[model samples]
Target: MRATLDFLLNEWLDVAALTRRPRFADHSSETFASVLDMSERLAATEFAPLNRLVDTQEPHFDGERVNLPRETHEALAKYAESGMLAATQDEDMGGMQLPFVVEMAASAFFYKASIGISSYAVLTTANANLLMVHGTERQKQVFAAPQLSGRWFGTMCLSEPQAGSSLSDIATRAVPDGGGFEDDALGPRYRLSGNKMWISGGDHEITENIVHLVLAKIPGPDGKLVPGTRGISLFIVPKMRVDAEGALTGERNDVTLAGLNHKLGNRGTTNCLLNFGEHGGAIGYRVGAPGEGLRCMFHMMNEARIRIGLGATALGMAGYEASVEYANTRSQGRRVGTSGKDAGAPPIAIVGHADVRRMLLAQKAYGEGALALALYSARLVDEQHTGDSAAAKDAERLLELLTPIAKSWPSEWCLEANSLAIQVHGGYGYTRDFAVEQHWRDNRLNMIHEGTHGVQALDLLGRKVPMEGGAALRLLLARIEDTVEKACTQEALREPATRLAAAVARLEQATQACAACSPPEAALSNAVPYLQGFGHVVLAWLWLDIAVRLDGRTDALARGKQFAMRYFFAHELPKVDAWFSVVASNDPTCLQVSADCF
Candidate 1:
C-alpha cells in the first residue's frame, strides 16, 4: 500500500512539486510521510481494534443520551490529539497547512482501518470546512473553531422526513424573533421548527457540543413559505445555546432526538431523526443570506461527496487486503494450466488457482483505480487553490466535471470489489466469522450517502455534462487524449491506449446524441446508463495513463499494474460499450415504460 501510494503521489501526479508552492513551502516529502506514518499507527492501534466492538454493540439511546462505548470516546480523543482534524488549515489555526492531496492520502488509513468509527471525524471536518469558507468571523469563532479543535462536533441537516433529497420541497420554517432579537450577536436569530431525518453524527456524547447546520425556510411577510429551493436558507442551530462569548449557557436547545435509525452498517456513528422546536422553536442563527441555503449547503455536500469516494476506496482496499491475505495462506487447490493436475500431487495455495487470481485482479482494478481517481481529484483541489489564474480555472472546470464521477464510481464499483472479496473467501465470507461481510455491509451506505446512485447519475448527465456549454467535458476528454497519444508511442501500451481512445470517441458520440434529442428528458431518461459508461471510460483513461508511466518497470508492483490494466481492458472496459449503446441510440424503453406494466 505504501509503495502504491508513493508511486501515485510522486511519480504520476508529481505531488512533491506542490511543496514549491508558497502555502506548502514549510513542508517537504518527509513531513507528508510523517503524517502518513502517524495516521497508520493511530488507526492500527486505536481504530482497528474497535471495528468489531462498535459494530456488535452499536450506539443505543437510553432516552437520556445516546449510549456509546468508552473506548469509542478514547479512540476519537487520540484522533483529536493528533491535530489531524484540521490538517489542511492555516498554521495560525494550529494546522500543518499541508496540501489537500497529502491530507487525503493520510486520511485513507483511518477509513481503511474502520470507516464506522472514522465517520464521526469525517462528517465533522467536512462541516467545519464549509463554515470556514462561508461563515462570519464571529460565527467561525463560536462554531467552526471548536469543531476544528475537536472540542465540538458538527452535523448538516438537509434531508427532512417528508422530503428526502428534494430540498426544494423541504418545509422547515425559521421565523424571526419579533422581540428585539433580530440583531443577536451570532447573527440574525430566528426560531427554527422542523424534523430532520437521516442525520449522521447528529447527537453524540464524545464532544462538549454539536453544531447543527440546519436548512430551513424563512417565512415571508405574508406568513407564507416560498415555493422552491430559492427560498431555502442555512442556519447554525447548536444543540446547546451559547452566549456572545461562545460560552455554553447551560440551556438545552429545543432539539430532540426523536429516534435513532438502525442501519445495516456504519453503526458506530449516531444516526438520529431529530425534531427541532418540539417544545418551542429552536433558536437558530442564520449562516448566510436568506434564500441562499441550497447554494451554501451544496458547498458542504460536494466536499462530503468526494470524502465519500475516499471512504469507498478505503473499504475496497481493506477487503482486497483481507482476501489476498487469505488466498496466499489458505491452500485449497492446484494450479490450473494447459495440462491436467496429477491426482497424487498436494494442493497448492488458492492464490495459484486461475479463478481466484481473476477475482483478485478485478478487485485490484476497481480498488486501485478508484484510489487514483480520488487522489487526482484531491490534486485538482490543490491546483484550484494554489495554481495561477489559468491553471486554477482549468482545474476548477475539471473538478466540477469529475465530482459526481468521483463520488459515484467508487461507491458503485468498489462495493462490487467488496462482494468479490467475499466470493474469494467462499462461505466464511458470508458469516460474521470474517470482516469482509462487515465491509460489505458498511459500504452499502455509500451508494445512498450524500445522494443516491440515481441522483449522482442525474447530476452527471443532466447538469455536469452540459454545464458551461460543455467546456469541462471537452477539457477532460482532451486530457484523456493526451494520455492516449503518449501511450501510442509504446508497443506494449498501444493496444490499451487504442481501446481507451475508442471508448472516448464513443462517449463523445453519445453526448452529441443526447444533446440532439428533441426533449432533454429523453436524453436524461437513460442517465444512469450514461453515468456508468462515462465512469468506466474515465477509469480506462486513468489506467492507460498509469501504464504509460510504467512502460519500462519490471518489478512485481509494475507487473501487478500490467495485469490489472489488462484485466480491466479485457473484462471491464468492454462493458462501456453496452452502457453507452443505449445512450447513443437514445433508447426510450425506460422512458416509455408504462406504469401499468409494473
Candidate 2:
C-alpha cells in the first residue's frame, strides 16, 4: 500500500511540489508518510479487529436508545483522537490543514478496515465541508465546528418513507416558527414534521449530538406544500439542541429514532428510520435560502460519491491482499502437463497457475487503477479550489465529467474484483472462515447506495457527456490522447500504447454515435453498455500511464505493476470493443421490450 501511495504522491502527482505551495506549506512528504503509517496501523489494530464483531453484532434500537458495541465507540474515539477528522480543514478551524489527496489516502485505510465504523467520520466530514461552504457564520460556529472536532456526528436526511430519491415528492414540512422558538447560534428556527428513511449514522449515542441535515419543503403563501425539488430546502435539526457557545442544552429536539433498518451488508453501520417531528415539530434552522435544498445537498452527495468509490477500491484491495496471501501459501493441484502416474510430483502454489495469475492480475488492475482514479479526482478537487483561475475552471469542468465515473466505475468493477478474489479462494472463499466472503458482501451494498448503476449510467451518458456542448468530455479525450502519445514514445509501452489508443478511439466513436442519435431516449437505452465501455477505455489509459512511468523498475513490485498493466491492455481492453459495439448500434431491445415480456 505504501508503494502504491508513494508512486501516486511522489512520482505521478509530485506531492513535494504541492506541499511547497503556500496553502500546503505545513505539509511535507515525511509528514504525509507518517499520516499514512498511522492510518494503516490504526486501521489494522483498532478498526479491522472489530469489523467481523460488529458485523455479527449489529446495532440494536431498544425502543428508547440505540445500542452499539463498545468496540464501535472505542474505534470511533480512536479515529477522532488521530486528528484526521479535521485533517483537511483550515488550520484556524482546529485542523491539521492537510491536502485533500493525503486526507483521502488516509481515509482509504479506515474504509478498508471497517466501513461501518468509518461511516460516522465520512458523514461528519462531508457534513462539515458542506456547512463550511454554505452555512451561515453562526451555523458554522455552532454545528460545523463540533463535527470537525468529532464531538458530534451528522447525517443527510433526504429520502423519506414514501419518496425514495424523489426529493420533489418529499412531504416533510418545515414550518417557520412564529416566535414559539428561541434563537441561539443557529439562525431562525422552524418546526420540521416528517419522517426520513435509510439515514446512515442517523441516531447513535457515540457522539454528544446527531446533526441531521434534513430536506423539507416550506408552505407556500396558501399554506400548501411547495411542489418538486425547486421548492425543497435544507434544515439543521440536531438530536439535541445546543446553545450558541457549543454547550449542549438540556432540551432534546423532537427528532425520534423510529426504527433501525436491517441491511444485507454493512450491518455495522446503523441505517435508521427517523421521525423528524413526531411531536409538535423538530426545531430546525435553515442552512441556505428557502427552496435551495437540492443544490446544497449536491455538495455532500458529490463528495460522498467519490468517497464511495474509494471505499469500494479499499475493500477490493483488502480482498485482493487476502486472496494473494492464500494463493502464495496454499498448495493445490500439480502442473497441468504433469502425469498422474508420477507419484513424486508435488503440488504447486495456486499463484503458480496461469489462470490463478489471471484472476490476481485482474484484481490488481481494477483495485489499483480505481484507486489511482479516485486519488486523481481528489487532486482535481484540490486544483479546483487552489489552482489559478483558468486551471481551477478547467479542473471543475473535468471533475464534473469524471465524478459519475469515479462513483460508478469502481463500484461496478471493484465488486467484480472481490468476486474474482472469492474465485481465487475456490470453495473456501464462500465460507465464513475466509474474509473474502464478507468482503464481497460488504462491497455489494456500495453499488446500490449513493446511486444505482442505472442511475449513474444515465448521469454519465445522458447528462455529463452532453453538458456544456461536450466541453468536459472533449477535454478528457484530449488528456487521454496526450497520455497515449506519451506512451507511444517509449519502446516498452508501444504495444499497450497502441492497444489503448485503439480502445479509446472506439470509445470516442461510440460516444459520438450515441450523441448524434435523433431521439435522446433511443440513445439512452444503451447507456449501461456505453458506461462500461467508457470505463474500460479509461482504465486502459490509466494502465498505460503507469506503464510509461515504470520504464526502469527492476523490483518485484514494479514488475507486478508492469504485468497488471500488460494484462489489462491485452485481456481487458478488448472487451470494450463488444461493449462499444452495443452502444454504437443504438440497440433498442431493452427500451422496446414490453412490460408483459417479463
Candidate 3:
C-alpha cells in the first residue's frame, strides 16, 4: 500500500540528489513524509468516503445550472485550505516551493481516493501553472490567485464539436476588440466566439469563477480563417468578468453552458459543452502571442498527460486495495489437489490460491511501476527547472521522450490491472457492489483523456523517437544500462539483468527499424505496437532498478520487490517481443485492410 517509502526515499533521494541543492535547504525527507501523512489522512477521511457516493449520485444539471454534492465542495475547500493547490509554485505566487516529485507523491493519495472529485483540483492547478508560465504579471494576480486559493476553478477549452484531436481543424475564432471597455491589468481583450465541447470542470457553481483557457484562431489580415493550428491562439475567458483587483465586476462574460456531457465514469466532475461569445462575443484576454495556442497550451497539455497517468495508476491502486481486502477475508474453495476429507474441510482465503496471487502481483507490478514512472517524470520537471544548464537540457530532452509513455503506458496497462482486479473478485467484481467496478469505469477514461493510445503512439514513434537526432533515446538507453550494470553485480539479479539487457537490445533494434523504414505511411503503421513495446522495456528497467536496490535486504518488502521483478520479467517483459516484431517489420496488415473487409 505504501510503495512511496521505497520510491521516494530510496530511488528519488539518490537519483535527484535532493540534499545537495540549496533550494531544498529547508526541506528534508521528514518534510516530504509529513506531506504524505497529511495527504493520506485527508484522503481517507474526506475523499475516500465520497468516492462511491459521487459515482452513484453524480452531478446534476438542469437547463440553467449544475449542482454538485455538498461533500464535494467541503472536501475541495479542505484541500485548498491545506495549501496543496500551490505546493509547487513560487513563494511569491502563494506556493511552498516544494519539489515537484513530492507534490506529485502527495497528490497520488487524493487521486487514489476519488478521481471524480479530484478533477476540479487537477484542472485548477494545471490552469494556474499555465498562467504562471505564459500569463502576464497582472494575469497571475487576477486569474491565478483565485484559482490557487481554490476560490475559482479553471478549464482548458481545446476540443470543439468537429475538431476532436485535430487542432488544425478548429473553427473557433477570436477577433481583437475595438470597443473602449477594458481592464488595465489583464491586458488586451478580444471578442472570442466559439463552442468548446468535452470541457471538464467547465461549468460549476462550487467556485466563484471559472477560468476557461480557450483555444481559438485569430483571422489573418485578409479577414480569412487561418488554415491550421498555426493561426490558433490561447485566451483567458472567465465565466464572469473580473477587474484588476480580482473582484467580480457584476458583469458576466458571454461564456455559457451549452449542455452537460453525461459520461460512463467520473460523473462527479461536470463535463460540458461551452458556448463562448454566443450573445455577442465572450471577452477574452490573450495568454500568449497569436498563432501560438497549441504551443502555449502544451504547457497544460503535458502536465495533464502526466497527471492522467498518475490518476490511472491511483485508480488501479484503489482497485487493487479493494480486491486484496476481499481476497484476504472472503472464504473460497480449498486448494486444487485436495481429497474428499479436504473437500469437507474449511475453505481458505482466496489469496492463498496461486492464481489470485498472480493477479495481485500483476497489479502490484503495474500500479507501483506506474507510480515510479510518474514520480520520475515529476523529478525530471524539477531537474529541468533547477538543475545546472547541461542537466536541465538533458532532463528536458528525456522528459519529452518519456512524456508520451508516461501518459499512455499506465493509461493502457493500469486499466488492465483494474480488469484483473475485477477478475480477482470474480462475479462480485463485475457488479456495483464492489469498488473495483467503479474504478474500472473511471480508469477507462484515462486511455482517451489527455490523448488516445493511437495519438500517443504517433507522438512517441513519429516525433519523440526521432527528435534531436535520437539523443534522448540514447540517454534513456544509457540510464537503463547503468541500472543493468548495477543489477549484474548481484548474484540474485544477474539473470534479470541479462534478460533486461536483451530487452534493451531488442528495443534498440526496433528503434533503428522505425527510423530506417521508408515511407512515412509504412513506417508509422505499427506505432501503437512500438509504443507498447517501448513502454514494457521502460517498466522492466524500472523493476530491475528497484530489485537491484534490494539486493542485500531480506525483509518482506524486499521479497515483494524481488517477486514483482520476477513477475514482470517472466510475464510482462516478453510481451514486448510480439509488439516489437510488429513494429520492426513495419507491419502493414492493419493499415492495408480495406473498409469493406469489415
Candidate 4:
C-alpha cells in the first residue's frame, strides 16, 4: 500500500528532482532533500520492518527491572550508527550540522516508520540542544557530548501528579546540600526530591545512562515557593554519577522508575512515573541560573513543539498515502454509469468512485499542505539561527508567530486525515491485520503531545499574536505579501496568487479586528476560530508558492504539481473566506453562554 502511494507522491511530485537542484542556489532545499532521502531509505529498510514487532512486544518493567524489545534496541543502535542521531548537532561534535529543515525532513521518515522510536530520538536531540545552549563548559563536556554521540539518552521531566500545564503548581523541590564546591566545579550540587509523570523514555535499556532535565523549586531567600516561574530552576540529574576521569564508578543516584504507563498508542516508548530521592536524595546540579528553569525548559519545549507538528504531518502523509493506495487497488463496486450495464462484471477499484476520490483528494490536500507548512517553519528556524542579523530577526519573529499554528493546526487536522484513512480501508482498517488502524491510533496522540489544540489556540490568540505590539504577526504578513508579489509575475499562477492575496488581506483584517476589541478576553474568545482562519491563509500561500515554482513547465511532474495547486486553490482556499466571516463578525454566542447551561 505504502509503495504505491510513495511512487505516486514521491515520483509524481518530483520531490527527488527538487532535491537535485543546485546546492549553492538552493542550499536549504538541497540539504533538506538529502536528509529526506537518507531517512526514507533507512525507514524503509530498517525501522519499518520492526515497527509491528516492537508494537506487539512493548517495553515492560518488573518493578526493579525493565526490558525493551530486542528489535527496538537494535533499531536504536542502527539509527545511532547511521549518523541520524547527530543530524542536528554541530560538525565539530561529529554531527552533520544539517539545518532544521533537513532535520524535519529526516524525521518524517521515522514518524512514518515508527512514531514511538522517533519520539525517543526527538527528545534526545531536544534535550541535548538545551544542554548545549545553557550548560556550563564542564556540563556540556560531560553530558551533552555523550548524548549527541548516542552513548546516553535524554528526557525532559516537567509534569508531576500535582502539576500539568501550570508550573506554579509544581511541588518538586531542590534543596541546597551545603557541599563544598571546588573552583573548577559546575555548581554546588543539590538534593532533588519529587516525582515526575508522563516522562517519555524515562526508563529503558536503550542506553547506558539517562539524562533528565528536571524542573524543581529551590528555596529562595524569602522562602515561600518564590511566587511563580521565577522560583523554578532547571537541574541536570543523571541516572548514575560519574567520576572526574569520566568513569561511571560512583554510586547510583536515588532515582527509580516507579512504574510504566499503559497508553492507547506509542507503546514502544516507555512513559514512566519517575521517583527522585527515593532512598536518600538524588544529587542534581543546576544547569543555568537559579529561577530560570522554565526559560530553559521552554527552549526544549519550543523545539519539541515544532518537531511534534512535523511528526503529526508525517503520520498524516503516511495515512493519506495508505488510503490512496488502497483506493487504487481495492475493488468494491462499479462506477455510477456502469453499475447497471456491468452487473455481472468484476467490480472496479474503489478509486473509480467519486466519493472515494473525494476522500483521497481531501487527505492529499490536508497532508501535503501540512508537510509544506512544517518544513517551511523548520527552514525559518534555520534562518533564524544561521542567517544574518536582519534575516535572523525576521525569521525569529515569523517563527514565533507561526509556532502555535504549526503545532496546533496539523495536530487537529491531520488526525482527521487519519480517521479518513480508516474509513477508506473499510473493515480491514479496524483489524490488526492492517496498519491503518495503528496509524489512526498513533496519530491520535499527537493532538495532545506538545500542547492540546485549545492550549495552543490560547497561546496564539492571547499572547503570541498580540504581544510586543504584534510585531511577529506584522512581519509574517509582510513575508506573505512578498511571496504574493513574486508569484504575480508567473502567468499560470496569477489567479491562485490573486486568491491567496485576498485571503491574506482577509486574515489581516481579522487580526486587526481581534486586536482592537475592548477586552482581551473578547479577542481570545474566538481564538480557535482565528487560528483556523489563519491556518487556511498560510496553507493557501504555500500552495501558491508551489504553483509559482512549477509555472512555465511542461513535464508530467510539473502537470501534477499544477493539478494539485489548482485543486487546492479551487476547492480549499474558499473555506478561508467562510472562517473570515466568523472571525470578522466577532460573534459572542459561544462566550455568552454560562458554564451551567450545559
lDDT of 2 at 586: 87
lDDT of 2 at 147: 91
Give the per-residue Cα lDDT of candidate 2 at 529.
Answer: 91
Looking at model 4, report the run of 10 residues with the lowest lDDT sum: 16-25
In model 1, residue pairs whose N, Cα or C atoms come closer than 3 Å (at least 3 residues apart or on different chains), thus clashing, are none
User: What TM-score fits each model?
Assistant: 0.99, 0.97, 0.97, 0.91
- The clash count of every prediction, one per candidate, is 0, 0, 1, 0
Ranked candidates, highest lDDT first: 1, 2, 3, 4
Give the per-residue lDDT of model 1 (tens digit) for 470-545. 9999999999999999999999988998899899989999999999997889999999999999999999999999
lDDT of 1: 0.92
Indicate the worst ten consecutive residues by lDDT in candidate 1: 334-343
The local distance difference test score of each candidate is: 0.92, 0.89, 0.88, 0.79
Clashes of 2: 0
Off by over 4 Å in 3: 3-7, 10-12, 179-184, 337-341
Model 3 accuracy (lDDT, Cα): 0.88
RMSD of 1: 1.0
Judging by TM-score against the true structure, name the best candidate.
1
> Residue 136 in model 3: shift from native, Å?
0.6
In candidate 2, how many Å is residue 87 off? 0.4
**Candidate 4 structure, TM-score to reference:** 0.91
